[model samples]
Target: MVIINVLKIVNWFRVTNSADLRKYDFSEELTQMKVMKLLYYVQGLYLKLYDERAFDNDILAWRWGPAIQEVHDKYIGQREIVGEISEQDLADFKEVNSDERLAEIVEAVNEAMGNMSASDLVRKTHEERPWKETEQSDVIADDLIKDFFDKNFKVSRE
Candidate 1:
């Protein structure tokens, strides 16, 4: 179960990280800090609407804000995001693409949060409940994220 879960996260990281980099035209300016924070927002919004996590990995409360340790490690020491979306990763998102609502949610998240600077995103997530309730380096709970988005964003919990 654990290994299966880890592989799911790995594929999600490949798809999302690649999408983000492509959105930014693969600029050297895109850093790990920006990618991690954008991922938190995407995950939070997905949880709000779907009542489940967007990615399979744990998002830990880091000094900056919510950070996916796996994604962080993948881009460690890289100035710009560098990765290839595997055939499996493509297939996974292809499944996701069949769900129009999920596709819109992802597009909305990227459009809204993609342009923000890394520092701005960090500050915003710092004020959000999931990160605020977690101790440094602790995993931010899914329930906290769902509750925050549901209450604050007016997303229906039913």
Candidate 2:
């Protein structure tokens, strides 16, 4: 049912943005908070553009902002996430890249917010309807996310 594992999404970001393959130069390092926000945006934007969830993981309205619990737990205590890409990660990255639209959504989000500070991203998400409407620690529903993005985010599906 889950279209993609959340870790796979993390891996996609890690592998694609590595020195060998990184297309753009991002000065800020990738922190856990930034990753969490990126995931939130990717899911919401993908739902807006494609009428579906990018990953099935429930994004909760945490104190900081939108967060995937599993991902947060996995990277807890780590300020910077620079893990090596596993074989599975590479394969998953390839699969994600194969889907042109999905890849575009992911890349667009990374380009847009990848260098933003964690606090900036948190403020941005908190301003958004999906995060604002959801109660603290409550799961931000896909419908709310989709509807918010549908009305606010303008993109070309062509």
Measured by TM-score, the strongest candidate is 2
What would the per-residue lDDT of candidate 2 be over residues 79-146, giving only the tens digit for each residue? 87756767887998887888777789888998788767889999999899999999999999999999
Expressed as tens digits, the lDDT of each residue in 133-153 for candidate 1 is 999999889889888888887
Total backbone clashes of model 2?
A: 0
- Flag regions of model 1 displaced more than 4 Å: 1-29, 82-96, 154-158
lDDT for model 1, please. 0.70
Listed in order, each prediction's TM-score against the native is 0.72, 0.88
TM-score for predicted model 1 compared with the true structure: 0.72
- For candidate 2, the 10 contiguous residues with the lowest summed lDDT are 19-28
